[model samples]
Target: MKTGNKIKLFLVDDDAVFLKALQIQFMENDDFEVETFSTGELCIQNLNKKPDIVVLDYHLDGIVKNAINGMQTLDKIKETNAGIPVIMLSSQDKIEVAVSCMHHKAFDYVVKSETAFVRLQKVISNIFKYQKMEKELNWYMDRM
Candidate 1:
């Protein structure tokens, strides 16, 4: 558990306005330390900061020509640190899109909507809970 520390969050989206809005909302909460990136490449480059979680847009190629999409970025993130949980964000409400993200090892998928922030908050809570449980389980197993 992070305890007294704020969660390090990486927010990536090509939509400047939307990105700023999301960043603002998260920044309002004292529990998050957020960094914004306009492209998946930039996010990848800054992986050294070691964000606890990443909220990545599904379509990152909107602005940059030939920019890598979210899936590619997700793959790179997983390759770097499989344990870091990534939550995919997209305007696409299709089940297939969500399933595809899950198949690619996304921790969760959030569709952009009126209630997106609430859903993202719940998912983040679950991730911490799961991580704590896993850590405890590992500790017990080591004792055995």
Candidate 2:
């Protein structure tokens, strides 16, 4: 999609306050159209809406009994549509968690903190830039 169009984003986190804050934060940006979900199941159920990107929390707790964690949710999402970019969010900064997220095809893994939203903005910008370049390359390839 082009920059002229608002990027559809799905924000999935078990924290009600955090989720709402994220939705509000993204709403300030003209480039984003945000949707908030509290659990992996809700996020998965709305996949038909086809968001351009998904911000999924690493641990989904308290929302449901045995709710899918971010990694499992990532797997399920990729199973349905591998192309959708996903940014995995967690409060922990462990190497193994980051590697696992990458293994599951997450676009990026980010640790939650005071600066998390700022970093997320940067990642989203990068994803858009990369996607634009991919589209241009595909268009060139089709011309050959």
**TM-scores for every candidate against the unseen true structure:** 0.97, 0.93
lDDT over C-alpha atoms for residue 11 of model 1? 96
Q: Deviation in angstroms for 16 in model 1?
A: 1.2
Model 2's TM-score against the true structure: 0.93
Instruction: Give the Å error, residue 42, model 1.
Output: 0.2
Off by over 4 Å in 1: none
Clashes of each: 0, 0
Error in Å for residue 141 of model 2? 3.1
Which residue runs does candidate 2 get wrong by more than 4 Å?
A: none
Residue range 1-144, candidate 1, lDDT tens digits = 368789999999998988998899999989999999999999999999999999999999889999999999999999999988999999999999999999999999999997988888899999999999999999999999
Give me candidate 1's TM-score against the actual structure: 0.97
